[model samples]
Target chain A: MERTTIDLWVGVFVAMGIAALLFLALKVGNIGGFEAGSVYTTHANFDNIGGLKAKAPVKSAGVLVGRVTEIRFDNDSYQAEAILSLSSQ
Target chain B: MGVSTRFFFLLLLHSGTCFRRPQLILREIFSSGVLSLIIILVSGLFVGMVLGMQGYETLQTYGSEEALGVLVSLSLVRELGPVVAALLFASRAGSAITAEIGLMKATEQLAAMEMMAVDPLARVVAPRFWGGVISMPLLAAMFSAMGIFGGYLVGVVLIGVDEGSFWSQMQAAVDIREDILNGVIKSTVFGIAVTVIALFEGYDAPPTAEGVSRATTRTVVTSSLAILMLDFVLTAFMFRGV
Candidate 1:
């Protein structure tokens, strides 16, 4: 086989491998490329907090506006705080 | 044992030149990695589909069939993807490399290379070694991606699971750095263990027909065992807290 053909095949093989990794990262894992957009960070203090988990969808009028970034127990106030990272549209 | 250890060190020392010029390694990758692509992909799809069906069956009782994506992706990425891919790679590529090198040895090509003042370890072994190492993680990743897609097809399309919930659960569970990257690391280690053992067995085979055949068989059997053992050790270290 010519050297160029070998190089081409190897290039294709490597590209496929990289594409698979990207698919795993982006499609499967939900890890997107770095975003520098501003995110509105706010906290909501709920009495019960229910079964709220981190990364749970924070909905506004049944629309997903942001994600619940962290859920914390406030010892001082004896309340639950949900830190929401709202994407700025 | 001592000879194999020495061979391993010698191969490593000669590996610097293997990467300096990429042609040889590229050729090796073509033979091992490119050839194994179809097997990896087809097997991944079937495994994922089976996992989807079985997981749906079990999770259905709990009324949590939506978690099928989670079960499929987590299992594929964390365990099945790397372990099974390496096993296939060992049987497919590892045995082939052993046979090629073992036959070359039986034909006295290695001795001729030495007589011509060329180091067979450098000229022959290192490229295949690094080639298998390079192919392993990529093949594993491709296997996992194909598996997840298969799961999606089975779960959302065929089984009528909600598409939104299926993907969301998967994305939520399959962390790239934690789950996916660790699996890549595991496969890379398995790749190293497999290729090194294959090369050693082939290089050390007695220069006879039966010896070459036995070495080829040993490559498949030993490397498969090595892959499983290494997978256990790696999983213990990587997934300890999780």
Candidate 2:
């Protein structure tokens, strides 16, 4: 019974450790790249969207400034227009 | 065929028969899949954290810290995620498999199975082979996801890169198909290579504890080397058109 209890604690500790690690990792890595506040909009037209998805980032000079808030076809130009929201730095 | 040619042919046939049993291979692959997933998730987080820190530091030097998203995404998706996960798997699970089978051989369990009219090849080898095949891509995906998360945490929260800018940069700079596919393809090949080498070494182990230990070490070392070599080959092929 004692050994089983110890084992249970060990499992709990491991689970907590993994969770903590994941939290820290996600906090530090910024993998999802979601941010709050600071919204400015811009547009871009692309011939092929390919795998581009909504909420994808908008980059200028190799730096990320905003995310794509909306995407639609510009019938006049026959191009995909991406509306991006830039953050205030 | 001449006598020499016949002898060579026999050797080839035996070698082929020893390793290429699909059912046995599949079983091994299934087991490897579970093991590989755990390793990949853990390693992916670390890989992402490291990439974020290093990329941030470098970008800061040039007053371009906001490029962290692009750097982390590209590096994780294209290169670091799969390779680091593969290395971790090679060190952890690859060594374990080699040692387990090596010990079995040393204890004559393999011979016992043969004596009992059981095919050790079918029973022992197949599961691990298939396990590796199934596990590798799953592991790679976990690694990629964790890595991206790690970068997000550091780049946005710690450095205060404005959440909007950080994500936007990542989306604009990263070509999802290119980055994600690179990792998947590399991981699949790495899984096969690790499985084959570990299984081969385990089965070929000498009948002693010392021999088993040596085989385990060799499996780890060789699998790591194989991953690196194959990474280069795969990268070359992947980028040839680009």
Candidate 3:
């Protein structure tokens, strides 16, 4: 009976540990945050992105409506281009 | 003394034999680990609450209060979780381990076992050592999780930081492989270092009451210093490019 109690407690402890790892991976790491959804891609050109980065939120009217997907320098246009994936909502 | 210390460490190296039967190891874990878990959980909660309060006020000045979750989670997961948990483990479990073994030595129990042709190292020290090593990482993880929850409580419930923004921003910012996994690795290494030190100090202590007392004190001090130094080296190696 005592053995079972200890085993149960240790089992719970190990489960908690694994749950913490999963929380860190899924929530903090954003592993599954991006999923197949109604997303529209749009491109914008700027002289410079000014520290903007991929995965940075694209806000409109202080609302996060999309995220920056890709940023690159377009040699042909001699400008920085940013691709954004906007949620339909 | 030199010969005995080497012998103690050799026994530690082969301590994996203690795990041959899960039942023996589980008993050791119950005795040595339960208290440390409670300590880390309470400490983690308070630490996270403090971080949440502090992060909210500071970020509010810059209009970035939503970043509180990212700030609190990152700080706890990357640096504070392993470091603080290990320190607490050293003081609580580590000191207890040293004193327990030292007391046994002082009472000549270890010697009695040796006379009977029983290896005291394997029968006693190895189980305790393995218990500590197994406990540290789990304790650290619990600490981090409770800390994050504490931050959530303070930031979202009390401080009124937007809950969605707090969590979303944190998710976007922190990386599992880079931050959380590295922290787990750090705690595991710290666990090994602390348990080994505790066992070694106790095993090598002079078989006297005063000697046992001094060994307990040494367990905390030496393990703390070792933890800090190792944290520096590990942080340098793990985060060099980033």
Candidate 4:
């Protein structure tokens, strides 16, 4: 019984550690954010994404006011087209 | 043949032997899972704390202590966290695996398994190989994230950087795709390398207790060296175009 309780506590601590890690990743990665008043959408083309994923943050002038919503290859140019949603300035 | 060709030949032979037994290897991994988790968690916390302190001090001189968030997060997520976690895991787990297997071999357990038609590679090695593959990335992620938080605590709560600006700088500096992928890829490779080296040393150990001890020591040293070498190669290749 005591062993079981210790195991339970250990499990809880491990879970907390994992949760804290996930939170940090999300915070640093800027996964989800939606501001209240206004938002706009824009697109950019790049020759290579270099492992960029959907929902990766889009930065302009060093602030993360938006995130990438969609990514597709341009048929003609064969480049990545990223659709970004930005909060109004 | 050239020296490189001979080295390549030996590597191929080693890999072939390592892949022989899957199920037995997996069973060993399952048994050792809890111990591995504990080691990872403890080491990760220390790595994060040290990284935060160092990063904060460096950024202070430039009057960009706020950028410590960026520096810590970027460095940990991309490189240091994974490498350090892997090295720790290799030292702790790799040496243990080598010694355990070497002792079994010295005691003729391996020979018994072979005589009974049980493939030792499948039973003894493959599980460990896969365990390292799975565990290293998870551990790396944990280490990197914890390190970032440590930086946040030091940079914001202790050092007086505004919370908002610190977070912003961190968010700005991180290219999620590049950073995360770099860590995951390096750890995966490091895991495989560590497991292979440990298993190799164990299987090749001389037939005595002294031999097992020597093999354990070699496993730790070789795996640690391999982790650093692989980190450099992966960094150069992954970041070349970035």
Candidate 5:
């Protein structure tokens, strides 16, 4: 009886640990940036994006609408080009 | 010096053989791990609550209170979760392991086992070592989970940070492979270091009551220092690109 009880508690402990890993992978990490459907890519030219980097969230009125997929400099136009991928949502 | 070196080698040798008995390892895991788990869970909760409160106040100043979840979860998952849990493990479980083994040594139980041709290192120390190593990562994970829940309680339920934004922002910001996995790796390294130090100190302690107490104290102190030192090195390596 005692052995089974201990086993039960240990099993719960291990389950909780696995649950935390799952949370990390799914919620916090979001794993491979999984999104439903497809994302729409839009290009915009900017004078300077400052410290903006790829994968930065694109927010509209304090709501996250999309992500910056890529950033590059257009030397001919002397402007920064940012590629944004907006979720279908 | 020669005797101590030989003893170290014996510990290394028996560590391999100790896994043969699953029952004994399970018993040691119960004795050495459960208390640490309880302590770490409570600590993690409180830490997260405090973080939620503090983050809300600070971010609210900048009109960014919705980011509380990101702040709390990222902090706990990336750094505080593994590091603080390991420290708690060192103080609670690590000290206990040292004291238990040290007491056994002081009472000449180890000597008796040796005289009977039983390898004390294998029978006594190795199981405890493995028990601790197995426990640390699990304990750290539980700590981070409870911490995230605590943050949710404080930020969403209490302070009224937009529940959706808190979780969604956190999910968007944190990376599993980069942050969480690295945290696990950190805790695992700390587990090995803390347990190895605890077992070594206990096994090498002078067979006296005072000696046992000193060894227990050494286990806590050395484990804390090692955890912090190793955290820095691991962080530098893991976050090198970022």
Candidate 6:
């Protein structure tokens, strides 16, 4: 094959590969959160957290408000605490 | 093993020259990565379809079939994309490289290049090595992307699963760093391991027809085994906390 033909094809292949990575990142992986959105954090204490975990969806009245950033045992309060990162939107 | 290690470092020492002749590397990439795209994409689609079907079968038992997206994406991005793509790359590009080099040696082309004051290591071997390395991770990424599309086709479009839940649940569960980054890291590691093994086996083969055939076989077997072993080690390190 001509060298230019080879170069053109190689360029296409590399471009396709990059496009695939982008698709994985933006579309499939959904890494777009919190990039432009401003967020605020708040704390809530519960006697039992049940199965609530970090990054769990925080729903208010059946709508997603934000996510749980951290779930920990409160040494002082003798209860479980959840740090919620709520989006301004 | 000792001889192969020496060959590997020598290839690395000569790697700089491959960049100087950009066409050499480009040609190798064309032959390795571009040619292999069809198989990677087709195989990815089939694998994803199977995952969707199986995922639906199991999840429908609990009436939780919407999580099919999560299952397919996680499995492909986390494991199958890197592992299966690497295996296909090894068999397709890796073996081709080894066989080509072995044939050149058998035909004394490498020696002729040396006679003409050309460093075959620089002019020939390095480009192929770097080419495989560059091609591998890209191929894996394409594999993962195609697999996801395939799963969407089968799971949502055909099977009547809730499209919104499919994507939203996958997005919620699959993190950029935790799932996707770890996968990219895995494929890059596989790329290096596969390229090095393929190059070494070819360069070390005896200059004879039978030897060349044996070298090609060894390239496939060794690189496949190396990929699997390295996958285990990498998964332990990358996904331990998950």
Q: For residues B129-173, what per-residue lDDT tens digits would candidate 4 score against the true structure?
A: 665665666667777777776777767777677888788878756
Query: What's each prediction's TM-score?
Result: 0.89, 0.65, 0.84, 0.74, 0.85, 0.94
Question: Model 3, DockQ value?
Answer: 0.45
Model 4 misplacement above 4 A: A1-21, A33-64, A67-89, B1-27, B30-33
What is candidate 3's fraction of native contacts? 0.58
User: Candidate 1 vs candidate 6: which has greater TM-score?
Assistant: 6
Ranking by TM-score: 6, 1, 5, 3, 4, 2
Q: Candidate 3: where are CA atoms >4 Å away?
A: A34-89, B1-9
- What DockQ does each prediction reach against the true complex? 0.57, 0.06, 0.45, 0.22, 0.49, 0.72
CA deviation > 4 Å runs, candidate 5: A32-89, B1-12
lDDT of 6 by residue, B3-36 (tens): 8778889989988887877888888899889999
Give the TM-score (vs. native) of candidate 1: 0.89
How close is chain B to the truth by TM-score, in each candidate? 0.97, 0.83, 0.95, 0.86, 0.94, 0.97
Chain B global fold similarity (TM-score) for predicted model 2 against the true chain B: 0.83
Off by over 4 Å in 6: A46-53, A71-73, A78-80
Fraction of native contacts (fnat) of each candidate: 0.76, 0.03, 0.58, 0.29, 0.58, 0.82
- Error (Å) of candidate 4 at residue B180 is 1.0
TM-score between predicted and true chain B, model 1: 0.97
Q: What is the lDDT of residue A57 in candidate 4?
A: 69
Instruction: State model 6's lDDT.
Output: 0.89
What is the per-residue lDDT of model 3 for residues B1-242, given as tens digits with 9 covering 90 to 100? 47745865787676776877677777777766776778888999999999999998899999999899999999999899999999999999999989999999999899999999978878888888778888888888888889999999999999799999899889878766778889999999999889888988998899998999999999999999999999999999897452
Give the clashing pairs for model 1.
none
Task: Find the 10 residues in a row with the least total lDDT in model 5 chain A.
Answer: A28-37
The residue-by-residue lDDT of candidate 1 on B90-204, one tens digit each, is 9899988998999999999999999999889998999999999999999999999899888888889999999998987787677777888898999899899889989998898
